[model samples]
Target: MRTYLAARAACIVFLFSGSAAAAVSEEEFAQLRAEMLRLAERVGVLEEENRELRQVAEATVSEVQLARTEAQEAGRTVEEWAPGTTFSGDFRYRYEEIDVESRDIRSRHRLRARFGAVARLSNDVEIGLRLAAGSESPVSGNTTLGSGGTSKDLYLDQAYAKWRPFNGAYVTAGKMKNNFYRPGGAGLAWDSDYTPEGLAFGWSGEQLFINAAAIGLESDSRRDNHTFYYGLQGGARLPVGDTVSITAGAAYFDVPVQGESSFFGDADDFFGNSFNCTDADNCAYLLDYEELELFAELTYSGFAMPLNFYADYIRNLDADTYDTGWLAGARLGKASAAGSWQVGYQYEDVEADSVLALLRDSNVGGGGSDIQGHKLFGSYAVARDWTVGFTVFVDNDAGENRTGSGTDYDRVVFDTIFKY
Candidate 1:
């Protein structure tokens, strides 16, 4: 019985040992599978992180390029806004030592200084101002309001507002110099010394051009008075070819002169005598007068030598009879090959009548008012911005009454100008 019991115990021990070994193998296999799954999950997380980083890098690069492009566009905008802003001006000083061989005045020395400024306000607008210092006013005779001494005056040489509302039309308003006379090489009138407050309109296209203006005339003394005069002017320029052009224009003015009044104390003896009149001795009185002027100009600039000729007829519209006066003038000028030197000749003639007679006799009158004149002028460029000029002017009295005391007068002038 003891031997059978020992054998059974040994069999149970063997069975239990085998079962424990099997359990141990299963646990090891399960641990290995779990570790492999954990490694795969980690690899997937790393790959996703890499993809996100790449997207962020690409987005950052795109933003940087956009910023660079915007900076370039802003710089271009600024460059266009201030294109070609420039400054320019000129200074002219002239000395005229006059030795009048006539009996009116023996000798005189005159000095003139001029300064001007031109500014480009925008692509289509510009402003300018000119100041002058001299012994005489810009009036033809160089007359002064007060004493004959050096004086400084500010002239609105070009104080006008200009605008190009359309591609081919421009309008301007303010005090503007008159365009009645062409730009001549000589003569004070050609200098645009007289500027009237007015409005001007101009239009130009490929083959057509027109300019019209209406001006207000004011007295030299009472500038602010509401009393005023009006003038109408218009012109057209036609091109015949690449080198030839023709222009024509007309102007009309209505001037009103103020009347004078006086008070006569009461009671002269009754005129038992009455005034009588007959057709042969008829006399009439009027309180007002009007002046009218007509003008034309022809220019040939395409010729081997350029030339300009102009004429005008003036009449007293309110006079008792039909009396008319006229003016005729011509100019010739040439430029050197290098455009450094310019020479010119000018001739002007004036005819006399009743109105001209009164004007010539006025205190502010220069002999040229009713006289013929000729001018010879030359200018040389000393530097890019400097020029020296000389002019000789001669006048002859060709009036009905020999109104200018002398038959001839002459003057010579020298000038230098610098530009900035």
Candidate 2:
């Protein structure tokens, strides 16, 4: 543009100089100069508009690239999903103390960690798996806090599939988490750590629930006998008023055996140095049982905090003797969220055959049946997904008068737990 302007100036100078001999008109020179200025201004405006168009084009290209990259990332995520899935679990550090009637005293520190995941095959079907830091301890999933040089044991705690073919119905199979609700979250009927392997069906509605399961408890190859556990439970939940609600359930469980039912909570042969039934070492036993358990819970929300009162009763119709168990408690607060505090107290009288000795709450007289105790517990959520809790059990054998009855005991547990 500058060179063109300079050439134009030179031409005007030459024209004027030449025109001097012809005595040229001044108006023609002025008109030519004005036309040059207008042309330069138009070119400048066009150049600026062209630059803006280039910038707009570049921006559009950038947006296209970003969209392509996001699409690729979304494809990768879907390809990795087996349908779709979520993962969750918790960990806890526990300190325990057990003193038996001024005689036997024991203390231990333990760690319990478990992780699980669920993958949806569709809205109607899903698979779940839980892995834990312990062996096959059916009633306690804790690993002792020591033995550093030794390899830790990790077990498949649960591997199951749940299917919902219709509204308010679920069918589950394999070793699965308990589907029954215990009044006041009591551990009397089913231990906290017990996961039964079997087939189960459950249904829930606005005010009613039903659950049933058939569990394979044990197998005997020599005698070709099997122990099967069957259970059915139905319950109703009702609101009494604007500030109160009540829930109740009736349950029946039958654990029948061909002969001696020995597999309830007996230590595994590998750990307890006892021969399994399959072993040739002459190990055989039996337990025959059927239980009718009733449970109830009442909540009053009108208090400063919610107050929950709960009770459970169970009787073994097939036990030879001492076959009754019941518990009652009241809890204040849910203790589920951060900054929440909760306290609860319960008293239980459990006979030897009332509930399966091996599957009852381990904290009650060291997880054995034929025990009576007051369990007091409290918890505080110190942070999100973390809590500190303590539980005290003042327990004694219900059948202490009988020969070979277990001794009396008091147990305390302090734990710091984490969940995510």
Candidate 3:
């Protein structure tokens, strides 16, 4: 446009200056007009190029804005779906052998895998879900190896929500982790893998802790009564010396089972609890369980490796006889680092009707009551998050009713475990 205006101004000046126009020849005038035409053509071309450049710049800006908007939307969607989520998993492989008094020694290979996710919904609330390799057994999670290479089952191991209303106080509901204390991991009353379905409450102070739970035992709409288990425990830790500490606690459990009814749809599931069977489907518990437990642990950290001595005792107040169970053990060191190792030895005597047979340690005394045994276990961490362990159980029947009565029972387990 500037060149076009300049060309027009030159023509106007030539036309107004009559002397200058007359002095120029016709040929010169024609050449001047041709030059002016060329300048006009150049201006038109330049304007077209500028128009294309403007359009290209606008399109590039539009694409950048669109990409920015899409990226922000994606971030918001991710936040809604995955707020503070974390994943955890562990796997264990085992070789086990069980020998009874007169029966053939049984050997098997087993594997257990567990995967879980926990998400934080808020500062005060969180939820967890876990899947495990196992059947519907409440006390065991091992999947036996082999059956024509059949696919294994995956059970819902945990589905729970936890809410912490304040510091050191929390509530949990659903199929949740056990909140009750087990001194030195003793399985006299509860198994490690037994996740209960119900509600649990806990409070912890600097030197004291308390736990309570209301668990659902059996629920049947057709029956008039449903069974439930309630538990409460409180404990305190006291320092006796410079490197010595003692922890002591007491617990109470009430289990009221309806008579003349089968639990878990199988009378054989009693696992040595005193019961009378009327038929294959109808059985009655001999006694209701009102249990009182006293537990204590003493730890001395004066040595290079800490020494822990613990004892657990439970008595069923409702039963007349065979209603007591006890365990005493000592552990040295801890298998927490790559080069660390630990060894433990415990002696257990569990009589029939002492505790619920179905909930006690499954591997000890081959799964439940009427058993007295010694358990020795050791573990070594070869690397971080990886460990190998061995456990041996030497047990015998305390009563004549269980299989292979008055005979020796032994079980050996070798395990390799990995965690992430």
Give the winner by TM-score.
3
Query: Any residue pairs clashing in model 3, and if so which?
Result: none
- Which residue runs does candidate 1 get wrong by more than 4 Å? 1-86, 99-112, 117-126, 134-158, 179-191, 204-226, 241-243, 258-305, 310-313, 319-330, 335-340, 351-368, 382-385, 398-407
lDDT of 2 by residue, 1-420 (tens): 557656766765665575652564688767765676677677678768878999999999999999998898777753375448888899999998888765767898888899999998898999999999975778779988777657778999999999998999999998999888889878888888989888999999999999999888764456443667899999999999899999998999987652543554343322111123655543443345688999999999997779999999998887666778899999998667779889999998887667666677777766656677788999999887899999998854544523455567788899999998
Off by over 4 Å in 3: 1-81, 223-225, 258-260, 398-404
Ranking by lDDT: 3, 2, 1
Once fitted onto the true fold, the runs of candidate 2 whose alpha carbons sit more than 4 angstroms away are 1-83, 102-104, 219-225, 264-287, 398-401, 404-406
- lDDT (10s digit) by residue, model 1, range 1-420: 235435544544543465644755767645744664565566567768878999999999999999998898787742365553434455666666444454554333434445555456776775555555532222322323345554555444456667777788877777654534443322322233445466777777764555566655333454332334454555666666776665655555454432311011112210110112334333211222244655565677766667776665555565444234454556554443334666666555543321323212111113323445666777877776778888776653434333335355666778776776
Count of clashing residue pairs in every prediction: 0, 4, 0
lDDT values of the candidates?
0.50, 0.79, 0.86
* Comparison by lDDT, 2 against 3, better one: 3
Per-residue CA lDDT of model 3 for 218-323, tens digit only, reads 7555664477789999999999979999999999999986373545547646777888777776678878889999999999999998999999999999988888
* Native-referenced Cα lDDT, model 2: 0.79
